[model samples]
Target chain A: MKKYIAKRVLNALFVVWLVATVVFFGLRAIPGGPVRTMLGAEATEEAVNRMRAELGLDQPLYVQYAEWMLDLITLDLGQSLTSGEQISVMMASAVPRTLSIALIGVVVGLGIALPTGIISATRKGQRSDYVATVAAFLGLSMPAFFIGILLALVFGVWWGVLPIVGYAPLQEDGIVEWFRRILLPGISVGVPYAAVVMRMTRSSLLEVLDAEYMKTAKAKGVGRTTRLYKHAMQNALIPVVTVAGIQIALVLVGSVTVELVFGIQGIGRLLVDAILDRNYPVTQSVILLVAAIMVFMNLTVDIIYTFLDPRIRYGDEAS
Target chain B: MTMLEIRNLRTEFETQRGTVTAVNGVDLHIDNGEIVGLVGESGSGKSVLAQSVMRLVEDPGEVTADELLFKGEPLLEKSEAEMTAIRGNEISMVFQDPMNSLNPTITVGEQIAETVRLHQDVGESVSLSAEMKRKIIGASKASESWRRAIEMLESVQIPHPESRATDYPHEFSGGMRQRAMIAIALSCEPDLLIADEPTTALDVTIQAQILEELHDILEVFDTSILLITHDLAVVAETCDRVNVMYAGEMVERATARDLFENPQHPYTQALLASTPQVETAVDELKPIPGTVPEPIDIPYACHFAPRCPEAKEECFEVDPAFRRVGSEGHEAACIRREPVDGEVIENE
Candidate 1:
């Protein structure tokens, strides 16, 4: 077990290293230089040279990547070109806001989808199953942005029950107010994820139910509900977990649209702004952060398989 | 009194192409301590009949029986919960493919204990108490459960029950897995055990061992068995009473000795003759010519007439009723058993 855990940890670090290297070099290849974008067209050569040197952009690409990697060990993320502030501080503030929306959305999405999926699979060929399947397909086909706008128009603009667009930090307000501010965007962003999870759960459960063991369980006189939760759902969760892991990256991407639609000033919106202004360091850092998050999420998914299926472990004789 | 009596039981499945009748009007009876073998070819609906006893068929599948009684109680009238009480407690089932019959996630001992806890009235303290719990921990209950499992493992004569008990289904040999499944089914000491092709998935040698184990277990427990199989050799060896099903109908029913020695129905005689015997090196075994009819579009008359060499014009025109042929309880569903011109020829 210790060896298995060690191997997984090593693999995770290797993946993170590969991602960092790609991000460092990949951003440099983008059309314009950060030095030119940072300074306006009328800026002097002296000022531009000073700014580039100060930001370490004048250094060789390999040197910059090595220094950045070393700095990561000391918990330093360098400075943002646009804000002239520490990237860590900007991320510190923005991470919570982005996380708050994504976390709640993921929780709600899973909570709604799990029961819906199980019910649909159990009621296979019934009207309820048909309706759920059709609804999930529709949810998948429809864009989150369109859903977000439709919701905003109806709930925000017309009813005036929710704020049309903007984020209210929990530090500045009560829990209810905090929820009120982020809830709409969170749910709107989660709708698509929930639909995907629901469909996955339904299909997985349906397949598991058809397995021979399930028939054995039924023959043992186990109740339908008990059989579903005890024997079926746990086995079905492997696929759902895989989908959820991939969806985390998709959620991070979708949050950009959600932040723009809801007028929330989050990392996604900040990242978009930095890209538009050609703020190289901030854009590079943000892309690296997203890549890093995805790597970590995939690692988490791999780790979770050991717990979900005893048949699999980190270094069990390769299946 | 009869433990289970099923009469005119029919099961049909609604497939994408059309509705197909799997078990059509199968009548069966099992008295206490009686072992009845249901012998037939594949698609004879042996498993379907077993499943219908528990109402295990799901949506797109339907079962209808004119009379299905369990211990004098009307089984069709019972609620779901009541049926559940009867299942594990009274009539448990052991399936053919042992590797897939058990829950993959759970431990073998726990799976056995779970059935015990579900069916029996053991208090929580008594069931889960330190004394009972310690056995699992000390490897004592593990060994005992292991020993018993292995004994059952040995009952089926599977090698090394001690080591085999700790292993998962994938770890065991096919015959060993079947033995483990038998152990699971017999754990609760159920009144009736429905074994659906218990040896079909096993090799010939292992099949004999499993049959021996089943026979020994039944002898000790006084438990009745409803054995479903396609192999006539197995039935001839293990069964006391036999029912021959053809196209979902019980075409012949008699004592195993009577059925084998003085076969009544033409289908039964044809089936017996078709099997390759140990003594015979017949150049070629006569294969039954026509296929079993498509159940959904089954002819209104005799289902086996199209396959029977002795079939008459009237056989294709009218559905035959089950008729008792002579003094014995040997019953056959054919119209040619009556005396005519000093020979049993046609309808009365």
Candidate 2:
């Protein structure tokens, strides 16, 4: 267990290094100077150069990269280029909104998907299964942004039932009101995620049902429900875990679109604004945050494998 | 009175390919305390026949039996609820692969005790009052039943019945897993214990030890066994009466001694001839020529005709009925059993 954890930590550090380096260089290569974009055409070339020096962008690429890495190692993400505030503090403000939206979305997605998936797989070739498959297909095809707008048009504009656009921090008010405000946008973002998870769960479960061990369980004369939940579902969860991990990354991507549609002040929206304004620090920090989460999510899935399957371990150690 | 009697049992499956007859008109009987070995090759439907008796065969697969009774109770007509009650209570089954048979997540002892508690009804007051009831009781079973479960494990010669029983299925070796399966099967002490190739997945030495342990258990218990296997040596060692199956039908049924000493059916003869002798490096071991017919689009008459070396024109035209061959209760479903010319090769 110690060795497994050690290996995972080292692997996570390697991933963070790769992600940070790629983001730094890729943003640098984009077809505009950061200082000129931030200052605009009104500023003189000398003033732009002066601004670039002040921002430390005038340094050689390798030196800038080394400084950034050093800052990152010391947990000093530096101040936002435009805001003149710590990037970490900016993240602290935006991350909760993004996470809340994603969390509610995930819960709703699983709530809709798990039972539906299991039932669809169990009933298999039945009317309900066919209906679920069709719904999943529709959900998969429909874009979250389009879905959000459509929902906002119907419910927010027409019925006036929900706050269609914008976000409220949960700290100012209670969780319930915050949840009520976020529901429509969260659901819109979650629909595709839920559909993907549902399809994966159903397919994986169907395969597990046909496995030899399931037959053995049934032959034991155990109740159908017990056999399904305990025997079949447990085995089926490996792929479900995988699909969920992938969905986390997809959800982060979807958040950008969701933030734009709903007018939510989230990290995804901030990242987009930072890119548009050439705010290097904010954009780099956001990218690093996302990369960190993705790395963490992947690590979580890997760690879960040992628990899910007895045969799996970090370094093929005798457990 | 017979503990279990299955007459003209047939299990047909409807697949996308076509409707297939898996267990075609097979008859089997096991009287009280008799271990009946149902031996055949893989596709011969030995497992299917055993499953059919339990009504474990699911939908799109129909199990039809002219008469199937357990202790004079009609099995075929029983409701799903009724069948559920019968299964794991009056009749318990141990499967071929122990790895697949036991639930992976559940502990070995809990698996056995669950079966015990499912069938029996023991009051909480009665259970609690008993001094021996230190451990948990799944559902409701008498305190004695828990001890009996431990005893069952011990009887199966499982090392460290207490500690080992707590371990899950994946923790066990092949032999130990088979032992745990036997423990679970025998936990309820059902009247009929169906061991469906129980030793097939075990090593040869383990298989022999398991068979020996099974025989010892049978000596003590009043239970009848339906031992299903493709291994002829297993039958010769453990079984009292042997039924030879070919392509879902029973080709021969007789005492183990009678069947082996004086084989009747051509398929049975071929099967015996094919049995590998360890002593001799026989250059050409006789193997049955053709494979068993496909379950779908099966032959109209005798299913084994294509594979039978001595198959005549009549074999293809008519389904040969089981005719009494020699001595009492000995039967075979072959055309050329009578008026044989050659001396039978006896295994010395």
Alpha-carbon interface RMSD for all candidates, in angstroms: 4.7, 6.0
Model 1, stretches more than 4 Å misplaced? A40-54, A172-174, A316-319, B14-18, B125-168, B324-327, B336-348
lDDT of 2 by residue, B1-348 (tens): 799888888899999999888888888899999999998899888888888888888778899888889999999899877876778878888889987777665567767765565566633222322212322223233355555567778888888887776667888998988898888777767899999999999999999999997887788777899999999889988889999998888889899998888888888889988998666667777988878887887755788888878878988987677777866777887666652332331211
Query: Per-model C-alpha lDDT, please?
Result: 0.78, 0.81
Model 2 gets an lDDT of 0.81
State how far residue A174 of model 2 sits from its true place (Å).
2.4
Q: Estimate each model's TM-score.
A: 0.89, 0.92
Docking class of 1: acceptable
Per-residue CA lDDT of model 1 for A78-155, tens digit only, reads: 888767899888888887778877887788788878989988988898999999888888878877677789889999
Name the fnat for model 2: 0.24
- State the lDDT of candidate 1 residue by residue for B211-268, as single tens digits: 9888998888778999999889899898889999988888888888889888888888
- Tell how far residue B33 is off in model 2, in angstroms: 0.7
CAPRI level of candidate 2: acceptable
What global local distance difference test value does model 1 have? 0.78
Clashes of each: 1, 0
